[model samples]
Target: MLLRTLSCLCLLSGVCLAAQAQEEKKAAIKEVTVFLKGAELRSESKVKLPEGESEIVFTNVAGNINEKSLNVGADNGAVVQSATFRNNYLKDNGPTPRAKQIEDSIIYLSDKRNLLQNEITAIDEQINVIRNNRKVSTEEKGISTEELKKLLSLVRTDMKNLLDEKTKTNDSIMKLNTRINLLANQLREENNRDDDPAGQITVKFYCKKATTSNIVIKYVVPTAGWIPSYDLRVPHINAPVQLAYKAHVYQNSGVDWNKVKLTLSAGNPSEGAQAPKLNPWHLGFYRHTPVSYSQPVYNQQTSDYTNTAQAGAIIGNVLDNNGEPIINSVVQAIQGGIVKNGTVSDFDGNYILKPLSPGRYDLKTSYVGYKENITTGVIVNSDKHTAVNIRLQPTDHRLEEVVVRDYKVPLIDKYSTGTGRTITSDEIDAMPTRNTRSVASTAPGVYDGLNIGGARGDGTMYIVDGIQVYGARGINPSQGSNAYDNTMGNYVATENRGVNTTFDIELPYTIPGDGKQINVAVKSAELLASYRYYAVPKMDKDAFLQAQITGWEELDLLPAQTNIFYEGTYVGQGYIDVRNVKDTMNLSLGRDKKIVVTRDRDFTMRSVKTIGSNMKESFVYKINVRNTRSEDIELVLTDQIPVSYYKSINVDDVEYQEAEYNKDSGELLWTLNVEPYKTSTRTFGFTVKYPKRSNINL
Candidate 1:
């Protein structure tokens, strides 16, 4: 009985061992497959699993996949006994179902958090800009309280959304941790199973979670206002294309309209895409269409105002070198032969002139402390917009009058090259002088007492009627000074020094008296060669002889029409005639008709003389004259016997009760009368001495 029982126990034990072996064989992995979306799997063909835990790699599988979808099953109709999903397979191929859901939630919340952060930063910067703008004056700043409040509300909403996303992300992380721990515990228990003794017939399952947050940055460009323009083309493709339009860019978000930046792009969607593109279009070009949030056009029918013919004017800004506005600047417009005046610049250095007739105009600008500006040919095309920039140079306000006179005399005070003096016409009228020569002495650096540099002070060339009188021959002895003597001679003489002589001939009267006019020219420095012979007197007798012979003789004999040439050029012409002659016991006397050549300062006198052949005759007569020094002369009478010729001699009211003739030479002499810028003439007679005849002659 014991032997039979032992045989049955052994058979039952063997059967149990065989069943466990079969279960172990069924637990071994047979196949592996990975499903992936939006990702690539490593192998597309069928894959067989190894006897132990095996791994398969699925590259870049979608994060949404779950570990529960990955299963291990028997190839035949046997039950999946002790089935296991390897940890390596799960980690490399897919994620747990619950873990994947949590991960997805975290990713979505993280994206929301990032978006809120960006919005917050942008709102903070905008708020700061608004606050800074508020500090400006009411007139200078631009912005409204309503706009600022709206921006603040938007920022607050973005902050709330960010906080909500953070809370959601933390919850997702906690739930995913708890689910991963449970899955790990379940896998360990299955691996430790021991139903039969062939390696415990165990199966292990594992799942890994791979999660990532992706931020999809999408940019939706803000819509812009529409602008209309016309494109015109020529028949030839190579001809230039023309587009005509006007538009404006304006700030919409509480920013400065002038300071906003703008860009433009244009293309025809159906064509070959050759179109003009303008960037920063606000500054460069304009279309006829209006833009969003922009002001209405002042005059819509006039594109650039060329044809509208409205009254146009210039609005200008005047700025200093430092770009500061100049106040109280005088603005004037020269238009239609009339000057219209205006006043100070406004606070922004702006000046507006309205309703100006459309034509060329000159804008004259002046300021108290700046140089004047003249802008010319400013054409105001009926309602057109034109801009002119003016930059002023600094000047002293006190020097306004002197700066206005642009006349500059070169080298007036400079001491470099030449030496001369300026005698204004004002000085000529104010100074005390008897003649132009004397007036010249009042000029600085001039000497008239004596000649210097071998030239007489009076010898300095007299420029009369634009003619040089230096070497003029046959000049009247009465019109000008002898040049060697310090005094110019007088034509009329009187007893008392201070008495005005009625018989005195005015120097310039000689020209008009002879049916001509006298116009005096300027006087300048004279040459030395002309007056060298008269430099020294030989003796008093020689001097007296020269005075009587050449000086008085020439003054009485020439006519005004006689041409006086200087180096072969006809400068002037005139004549002088001596008419009446008288004979005395010691001298002969004559009255002369004098004529002067103004171009050369020449004068001459002419007279007729006759002698009788009837009887013996002789005579000696006394003559007296005055000198240039205002002294009287007494001359001696010497030869005899001509009582028959006494009727030809006459003295008509001779005024010299104080010795008028020189006694030695028996000639009449008188002080020469000099007048300013004029020529003087006088009529006087002198006695000539003669010897008595011994007997009667034919």
Candidate 2:
């Protein structure tokens, strides 16, 4: 009986032990606690248990425990199953029933509940203490009932204030939670909006990646405006991708967000049709409307510039191949297009153009007789003057014939006048001439011998380039006569002398390799006037004859016949020997005359001691001449004055005179015979006297 009883006791004890073991197994749960720092203030509360190993999400934990700053660990004796940080959240102790939920709930409400309870308790204690002090009022510190009531009322007011604050705080938390839930819902709704299910989309704005990944987006704000946005929609997932997008801002439309276009493709940068998109995506805002660029207007008044500014400029001269001035050349400023201005050269073949805006320009010159020339890409600047000297080829215009019109006579022929003629280069080449002066002689009435208004002559004034040659002769003989002769008696007449007073000394040779045109102006009447002034002789024959016929018998025997012999007879028989004769003579001798004797005498003639007693009268001759030609030419003037009639023949004020004949051309050219019709005048001075007959040895 005893053995049976013991077996039963052992069996019962084993069953009890097994039952305790099973209860212990049921009590062992995976306990996890997540501590959230810097979280919303709230008290701990029960949370619903999650099935299986569930993850807990915490958002916007305040304080310093941010997503990057968060750290997770197990309690000292507790096991840490798992922990993770994701989506800017700190999650710890996962895969635990009620652990994550309970901690999250505590984190949510701990501060709020603690603050509310602490305020309540503090207010209650203050009210109680004031009541106790009123109950034990002393002489020194007695608390009045009314004062006590007021203090209690203040406590109640404090409680109300605290409650109100708590309510407001709770309201804010609820609103924030609602907002977060709305955002989460919206995300969920748009999750499938992407066309490429396998592709993960990302939007980088101003270098920062978007908060959400694998999303379709629009209306992204740029640095300036809002624009449509896009992302890669492809088969590849979680791949680093780049997309280029264009945004436009219209002048009239403000900003067009819908106009954005994005491109996506990949290849070698050099071989690609377009450049690959780069990181830190650049958002370019292009103009929808055409952008009109305006140049700045510089105001001289204020010394300020507007939106646009004026460019600097250059100024300089343009020349030809011969270093001569190029006239009427087109100078242009070229940037994208051309702006042109024309300038012509002055008399010296010099030109100046100024104040050109700074830019690249082409200098093109065109003249009638020269080939057109063009110089490309002439950089002009304000700092320096651009000097462009262009050498132009000879044009066909030089070969063309130049027609010479007949010379028109001036209205007043008697007055001194100047003649102008235009002779082109072609005409100069065609005309025959010994020198350039001969070319001028082709004109009618031009004298070749004197080179006065004649072919190959030098009577005309010669001006070459801008310099006047020395010894330039005008048509008037007095104006151009040699400086030696001052008296009118020695003046030479230039009338009937074809004088080419105008010639170009600049280009003496007309056919000197396509020479330029020459302009000439001749003054014939002026030459004549000059000749009459300085070339004609002034003599007093009457006084000379009176001095010579001193004897009265010789005078009586001289005449009784005619008035011409009266003076001679008066001085011949009874009168003392004549001393001098004087008279004014205006003689019009023929073209070819040697000795010009005057018939009229005002007084008697006489013989001076210098001559013999038989000599009675004395006379002097004077002459002058001029040269007119393009070039210097030989000139000669010959006069025969009887030595018997003149005591002395003085060749005074003679320029370039020859003693004998000229070997060249077998012509007496003591006066220059120029290339053309040139005028030349010569003057000679002579003193004639008669010896007395008594002293004469026959």
Candidate 3:
């Protein structure tokens, strides 16, 4: 009986000791590693444990933490028994500094409102007393006119002051209300859940003896990620391009990352790791086979980005002539003539090819206007970061022909979630649609200019050459608490689009503008064109120089006026109409003074005018064209005859030589091949008969 009683007493004592030895500690966030879609947080706390088991209650943990990723580590030989996570709904955690400032302002305004209310009440009481006193005095004695007027004036003054005070107080109250509302909105926008009350993590630990132990807790949260940005710079057209690899890491994961070491990864963790399989290989005639798939056939991703763990990384810029970065430049690392890895340059003209095997490699760089550059004997060591900056020379040969046909090529996107189209450097340089919104409208599914895929217009995120065109306040990894401005560089002009990502490039070209069309040059090519001089001597006595460039269907160009730069000079502006053009494109390069054309009256072969009940007039004209340039030239001379509106006005004796006559339009054309320093002439005569005294302005 004594032993049983002693054991019960000891058990009670042990329970009492455990209740007393329980420790409550809060962990301070020590480090955070933010990924592309989420962020991992590490926090530490120190606690003194009893010789037996003790419960450590950790406060201030994120409420939306992934419990599966929650882990606890112990130092100083303290063994962790178990850990539990729960929201600390009952804890009276103090408000954040910003929130507290807002609360304090609210309190102050509430006090002011009370003070105003009290003043209004006092004024009402004073007003009532004044009325009563004035009535009593008037009833006491009938005053004279001057005394009554004075009394009335005194009463008016007191009432007016009271009313004015009330009006001022009401105005102040309204202003305070407005300010409070604004403050509330500001607080909400800047909240980021840093104002959460509390969260608790109760960890049970055991130890052989009493000792102080440090516990570290870690978990991942989903509200944080990063973006890869690039800056590619080419020293010159022939020089190698230098690409700068950078990351813009942003996090709102309910914690601040201060002075923590950051390690970025190129792999997407949330993407499911599953291989795709074909249903069956059955090519039959119009058979509606019940082909069912867990994942859609079109939804399968071809590239497996699982190489981030095996190889090292290579990052750098691709620049062009004049030391500008080239946007959308292709950078590939090849080994044994096979492309092992490749990446496109971002806004900053930067490219990062990660998980590259350590060995001697050949890097190939290519851009729309630049010549392909391949550097052999480039070495990449294992577990090391190599900067393989590449530069490519400019090519004068332009791709002038693009066939209009159906291509089964599919676009692959890794970061985007919606559909978008890519605008190549050649395309950007080809058209003169200077409006960014207009340029973006060229993509399919974009509506009303910048409204992409039917989303809100403001939701359209425009990223240029890795920089967000619309600025935002994001957490700068290098500066945690400062603002990082997102400004599109002057050279950022070319583009690529994807489901979730839209690229705006920092191009090597520029077009200066002020409220006018920014006729920027995205790229230029010397297309093979047949030049000719076309003259209408009978109409304007001027000849237009035209260049017909075939195979233009390949250049994705819009119909716009192009600034013609011919023979190393800005000749003038010309129109390019591709709307109805099929196989050939015609460009008018303004007028040519070297191919002079003239129209004159032929007095030597005189025409006579006869008058009677009927009138007849005959006129003779001559056209002369000279090719003064040092090269042979081809030309077409056009002249027109008047079409009479009245039946009485009859035309006859039309003389045309070696020219095609169009009776419907009354136009005559002559195709002429003239040699250098040679002149050609053509003469024609036409007679018109009409009623007497009829004026025909011809």
Best by lDDT: 3
Per-prediction CA RMSD (Å): 49.8, 49.8, 22.2
lDDT of 1: 0.29
Reference-based TM-score, model 2: 0.19
**Residue-level error in angstroms, candidate 1, position 301:** 24
> Which digits, one per residue and each the tens of the lDDT, describe model 2 over residues 419-466?
222232222212222111222112121122111110111123333222
Q: Please write out the lDDT profile of model 3 over residues 361-437, one tens digit for every residue.
A: 88887653455688888888765678877765554432221111112332111222112232222222222211122
* RMSD of model 3 against the true structure: 22.2
After TM-score superposition, the amount by which residue 313's alpha carbon in candidate 1 deviates from its true location, in angstroms, is: 1.6
- Estimate, for each residue in 1-698, the C-alpha lDDT of model 1 and write its tens digit: 99999999999999877644532221211111100001011112123333443333322211211222333333312222333222222222133332344345445545555665566566566656555654442335454777657656665666556556655655565554444444444333222211111211123212232212111111111111112111111111111211111111111110011211122122111122366787873565756974342323332111112223456667888877666555334455666434432333543568765445577888877642355698999877666545666777654211001000112232222122112222221121122111112211111111222100100011122332232322222234332211112122232221222321111112221110010112211111111111000101111111111011122222222111111111111111111112322210001011101211111111232222334532222222222122332222222211111122444342222222223454443334333333323443333322232233423221
User: Best candidate, TM-score-wise?
Assistant: 3
Candidate 1 deviant stretches above 4 angstroms:
1-308, 340-343, 396-698
Task: Rank by TM-score, highest first.
Answer: 3, 2, 1
